[model samples]
Target chain A: DAGITQSPRHKVTETGTPVTLRCHQTENHRYMYWYRQDPGHGLRLIHYSYGVKDTDKGEVSDGYSVSRSKTEDFLLTLESATSSQTSVYFCAISDPGLAGGETQYFGPGTRLLVL
Target chain B: EDQVTQSPEALRLQEGESSSLNCSYTVSGLRGLFWYRQDPGKGPEFLFTLYSAGEEKEKERLKATLTKKESFLHITAPKPEDSATYLCAVGEGGGGNKLTFGTGTQLKVEL
Candidate 1:
């Protein structure tokens, strides 16, 4: 909830459709991450960006892709949505250079439902 | 692989009741352990970070303690407003900032 904001807080999509979620941050932190939260599975990281255009996959990267064109924006794309991908998505920001930067601050989160 | 496990998936307590939540972890290097409180429909808020065994941190009504294999979140004289899901996560050294999290424990407090 720091300065992070995720767009399309709630969305309902159909299977096989492409879905994109946006994360915007005003904090301009050096790191950004995308994670999905589901019942019983806890929160799994999808991808992360250390800097603009420098991205890497995470624990649950399959079926999900991420792009960061600007320092303040990170986007998560579900190439072909599936019911299994339906979950609450959250974006987080951090900057290790700052004190307590090891702690990640999260966005409000975006809830997606795939049918 | 780094793994975390939390006990008592759900717990119900009366106002002013004191209790403890447990989080156990298995990870190499054990960089840090974190505790977070999350309300329904909201992102998790950071609570405490324990860097080594025997270290303890405290807030108004919550206290977090760390051990070699696990961490404990102790709530003393809890209030109804303290109801929420408590999440535990661990970061391993040289793990590139990735954290392994537990499923979390849901707490419900009634007046």
Candidate 2:
């Protein structure tokens, strides 16, 4: 569906360790986003990139960082993983220039666990 | 602050049962309202987008309607395959493609 795929569908890491999740898209959309889903807290935006080398913080950007060096790849990194950071992370892409383009399609998602 | 609240955190219905899920929101300037269906272990899939009040969109057994303060997702004769979590989100003016989401309503269709 949107040619979006997230690597490391499931992962387990200990606290204070470094972890990075990857999102790859084939549609070459102008925008890509990262979100985390938790029990009782729905999905919250983590970060997003509009284009190569352009990125912005989201509602829950603390403890996380992202980089976009190419149109097809977006990466999210946790500086030091924490138990509280364990959750399902999702990648979404959208193209505002197309018809009904505001709609964001999502990737399969990555489940991360911090021990 | 833009906020969205979905009612009845969870619902269970027998096959062919009709029901409706509610989504209420408050935003400074409403740009768009979106509905998505998320299956277990998967990401959300776009369902509908309502730009203004008094608008309605439908696909198969699902119909989405929007008003000034709320939106409703109505299901007609749902099948077991219809079981999934429904999410509602709102895009506010000047938000720059960002959306505020509700917790979502989980629906389970039984035989």
Candidate 3:
């Protein structure tokens, strides 16, 4: 919706396989985040990057990892995919101003199905 | 712990019906509250941002109001095109500037 774009719009993988979802933002905002959306859980934060190589875990960071080697790209990796990990993944970007509040823009999302 | 909860998980309305969606939340220290509209198979689209309890924002057919403990999204004379899932999130003061989200309320408007 913003200038964000997620790669592999849809994918299906088997259990124990490694998968990586890519999120690229043209806005070049200072913050980037990864989130997963399920039927009843809504969107749960997975990881976020404040700057290049500066990453941190979020509410639901277990079984997942993230890396940001550049300002425009943030990647989420599933070391070993599980059925529980199957969900729609979204990437978001934000610029937190001096007021300490921000409205994040989101990417189209990548739907992953684990078998 | 900071958390968010939305009421009426789903809604069905007739064209021109006016209604309100509720988002209740508790945060460490609220920085802002946000409202988003999401269509099926798509990412969320930003709607409004409310900073203080007395603040209110408006779009064409939607109005958002904030309070100390919750926020409300009011839809007036909604059209079928207004049907979509509305999501609410809270921004807390932190280093990473992350947002905590609610499950969302799905709205269906039929003509």
Candidate 4:
């Protein structure tokens, strides 16, 4: 739960359009991540932010970019939407300083559809 | 590169039936192994994080055990509510924060 929420719970856009998904966390955790889940591919990280204004790419960051200007917010942007990019996106915050470190708490997810 | 594989792709269990889901992983270094439960149309919910071999964690009717090469999520007496996709992921600590995940095991429990 981690007090996380993602905006635009469901969206449909045409190919080549730019899309952005927002991930907000109230836990104020230092680490936040964006991941996409698809059939056969499970979940693949798109990007992550270790601190405000510090972002890094993940395994499948080719078509996506991210920004984190504040501690509680991380945004993932798809430069150009493609049918192949259509998938369920999830937001997660790492529970650092806890007994179970590196364990991520995920949001409800946003379903994006590209036509 | 690290790799994860979950077996039985899908499983069907009746109420009160007990079973186990397997997650096999190969990483350069094992930092933490995590288990998650995801329902349809929702993101994965964290369940357990095992740090080393022989370590185990439990929550109600679910128990997770980790070994050198694999982890097992055991269900002691599942109910219809227990039906969901179980996910396994592993981290190679100190290298990066990305956790490689398996495709997951879809479980269906019927009454």
Candidate 5:
């Protein structure tokens, strides 16, 4: 309920197809992150953006890409989806800082299924 | 490598039962520790944030305490609505805005 919304809350697609997910935030936070949640892996960061057009790769950035063209919109793209990428994706926003001021607010999440 | 481990992968408690979940972490420099609750098919919701060792915070029937190497999330007289996956994360010191999270402890409260 942090004014964050993810589009296509659920999706099912075949392998080798391209997929893109969108995360939009109304709060206009400075930091944005994309993460994937798996059963045993917890939540792994996929990519993060510090500002519009400024992005960095995370621990598991393989086969995935992200773009932040504006302050409120961040997009995650899968060049060629695979069954291994089937998981719940979450988007988070936070103010620019560390320690106590860096608490992240998460969106509802997108469940992706690849066959 | 920064690591966080949560104990008791799953816990079942009767309504009004009090219990605690543990989160142990190892990081270069501990900037802050966070507690989150995530329901099934939903994103994690922030519950508490502890800035340093010996720090504590509470909300409703939940309390979070932080130590140098570990943190505890104590639930008092839990209700059925308290059932969810509790996640703990550590934010490293300096300007690293990244967070390392634990696998989380799933708690189920029944009447």
Candidate 6:
């Protein structure tokens, strides 16, 4: 366990309902990311935070929002869950380094089903 | 646009068999290439990071090598426990912590 954890290992929600997933890291990494894994698509980034209150959109950020209020916690919120949003979500954290590419440690992942 | 592509999509190997998975990438400036192993229903586990061409890294029965345009994850005498989806990601300079990932190659090992 390299200090990354995601809440609600599994979830089922109705379409149009608001839902939020939480990612917590004990490592205090500078970068945190949220990604969704679908059938044919690889893990596509949804949102990421470089620091507290500093976030940016990823390739697939529509309908999703992320907030990082503290160093260890990053929250991803779906304003209105859709059936197309049913997928496994993953959280990852990476340390800052000169390598320009620090290795990311991932959480167990959350399986979400929109019915 | 930065992109990564993994080959075969899926591979089946008997226990103790050796094989390699390929990852081809196109980026503006390559900063690093990473390899990860993911079990079903779990997040990806970091395996290795290759920062430059001609770089190679190894751990246990897995060896990762990188070149200017692609990378490879080579498994030597793989075991049943080595069965998992092997993912490859590329990080580009100036991308600001963004990583582009490939679809991944799912490896199955049977005893």
Local distance difference test, per candidate?
A: 0.93, 0.95, 0.93, 0.92, 0.93, 0.91
lDDT of 1 by residue, A67-115 (tens): 9999999999999999999999999888866766778888999999999
lDDT of 6 by residue, B13-92 (tens): 99998999999999998867989999997889998989889999999999999989989999999999999999999987
lDDT of 4 by residue, B1-111 (tens): 899999989999999999999999999888799999999988898899999999999999999999999999999889999999999999886634679999999999999
Model 1 lDDT, full chain set: 0.93
How many backbone clashes can be found in candidate 2?
0
For every model in order, the fraction of real contacts preserved is 0.60, 0.68, 0.90, 0.82, 0.62, 0.68
In terms of docking quality, model 1 is: medium
Docking class of 4: high
Write model 5 residue lDDT over B8-86, tens digit each, in one string.
8999999999999999999998867989999998899999988889889999999999998999999999999999999
- For candidate 5, the per-residue lDDT at A55 reads 96
Best by lDDT: 2
List the candidate 4 regions with Cα displacement exceeding 4 Å: none
DockQ values for all predictions?
Answer: 0.77, 0.80, 0.79, 0.82, 0.75, 0.71
Clashing pairs in 4: none
Q: How high is the lDDT of residue B22 in model 3? A: 99
Cα RMSD for predicted model 4: 1.1
Which segments of model 5 are wrong by more than 4 Å? Answer: none
True contacts kept of 5: 0.62
Q: Which tens-of-lDDT digit does each residue in B1-111 have in candidate 3? A: 789999889999999999999999999888789999999999999999999998999999999999999999999999999999999999887667778999999999999
lDDT minimum window of 10 residues, candidate 2 chain A: A95-104
Q: Candidate 2's interface RMSD, please?
A: 0.8
Clashes of each: 1, 0, 0, 0, 0, 0
**lDDT score for residue B43 of model 1:** 96
